[model samples]
Target chain A: MTAYSATVTVRLKEGVLDPEAETTQRALERLGFELDSLSSADQFEIELDADSEERARERVTEMTERLLANPTLHDYEVSLQQR
Target chain B: MTAYSATVTVRLKEGVLDPEAETTQRALERLGFELDSLSSADQFEIELDADSEERARERVTEMTERLLANPTLHDYEVSLQQR
Candidate 1:
């Protein structure tokens, strides 16, 4: 089996209530930083031993879609690389 | 000023006790996933308008070091892109 690394980014889609993002934006403004818009996001990095890079990508994608991300409110993307 | 987007990933440094990572590793093992090691991590994406990309990077790095991450147990990396 090949060793693989995958990074998954999960974020609330546009127009979602992101209190953390809101708070950060306000805080930045207070610090005199200008921002047009802000959104809150999270990421996960998983290391896996799989048959191939393709297999690792497929599995990570399935995991994100099925468990790690909320489809209705969150969008996710997975990137897999051979290690 | 340039509009910029920054992503900061915070993770427990090596040798640190990471309960979340431990739990995830066990869960993956239960599901028959082959993982050599697992690390718990979190990501934050910040959008900022600053005088330049350099300024945004500097500010975000400061935020991560000062408030967003625990220096003793956590390490963070920041990436900035012009928007």
Candidate 2:
């Protein structure tokens, strides 16, 4: 098995209300930073041992589907690097 | 001014405790997914008008320093794309 690092980024589906982003934008404006809009996302990095790159991707994808992201509200992408 | 999109990724500094990631790792293990370790981060995407790419990056960097991340515990990177 080879060590692999996977990054899963979870984003709110477009049209979903993102209160955290809105609150952050408000805070930035208060600090005199100008921005039209802001959106926030969560990314998780995992280190694991897998047979190949495809296996690493598959495992991480399943992890997102099962625990890292909510399919109903989140859209997630997984990327892997051999380590 | 040009429309710009900035992505800022904030990660915990080395040795910082990340309870969220630990909980996620445990949950994944419970579901039969094996991993050596896991870490979580926050990413912010900002849409704004800026005079140049440098300006856009600067504004978002300030945003991270001021509101998006706690400097004592987190490190952040800012990247910009013209939109």
Candidate 3:
């Protein structure tokens, strides 16, 4: 098996209410920065062993579907690199 | 001022214990994936009005310093783009 690095970024689907992002947006505005909208996401980096870059991405995708992301509220993207 | 977009990524500093990452790592392992380390971060995207990209970046950096990131436990990166 070859070593690989993977990134999984999970974000709330458009239209979902993101309270934390809203809070931060308010705080930023309060601090006098003019902004339109703010959104937040979770990013995860994983180092692992996989046979190829495609396989690594597939594994990470499965992991995201199974554990890292909430299917109902989140949409995720995975990137992989051979190490 | 023109429209701009900024991305702020906040991550735990090296040596800080991230319980959530640890928990996810363990779950991945339990599912039979062999891995080295796992880390997680929060990414924020903001839309705003700025005179220039540099000015937008400056504002986001200030936001990171003041609230987006906890300096003692986190490190953050900011990216800005003109819209």
Top lDDT model: 2
The digit string of per-residue lDDT tens for model 1 on B1-73 reads: 7788888888888888978767866776677666676665777777777987788888888877766688998
Error of 2 at A71 (Å): 0.3
**Would you give the TM-score of chain B in model 2?**
0.96
For each candidate, give the interface RMSD after superposing the true interface residues on Cα: 2.4, 0.8, 0.8
User: How many angstroms is residue B13 displaced in model 1 relative to the true structure, after the best TM-score fit?
Assistant: 1.5
Residue B40, candidate 1: C-alpha displacement in angstroms: 3.0
Minimal lDDT window, size 10, model 2 chain B: B55-64
Candidate 2 residues lying further than 4 Å off, grouped into runs, are none
- Prediction RMSDs, each to the true structure: 2.2, 0.9, 1.1
B5-75 per-residue lDDT for model 3 (tens digits): 88899999999999999998999899987789899999999998888888888888888898899999999
Where does model 3 exceed 4 Å of error?
Answer: none
Question: Residue B49 CA error for candidate 1 (Å)?
Answer: 1.7
Spell out the clash pairs found in candidate 3. Answer: none
TM-score to native of every candidate shown = 0.85, 0.97, 0.96
How do the residues B2-30 of candidate 2 rate in per-residue lDDT, one tens digit apiece?
Answer: 99999999999999998888998999999
Q: What lDDT score is found at residue A14 in candidate 1?
A: 81
lDDT of 1 at B67: 60
lDDT of 3: 0.90
Error of 2 at B14 (Å): 0.4
**Order of all candidates by TM-score, from best down to worst?**
2, 3, 1
What is the clash count for each candidate, in the order shown?
0, 0, 0
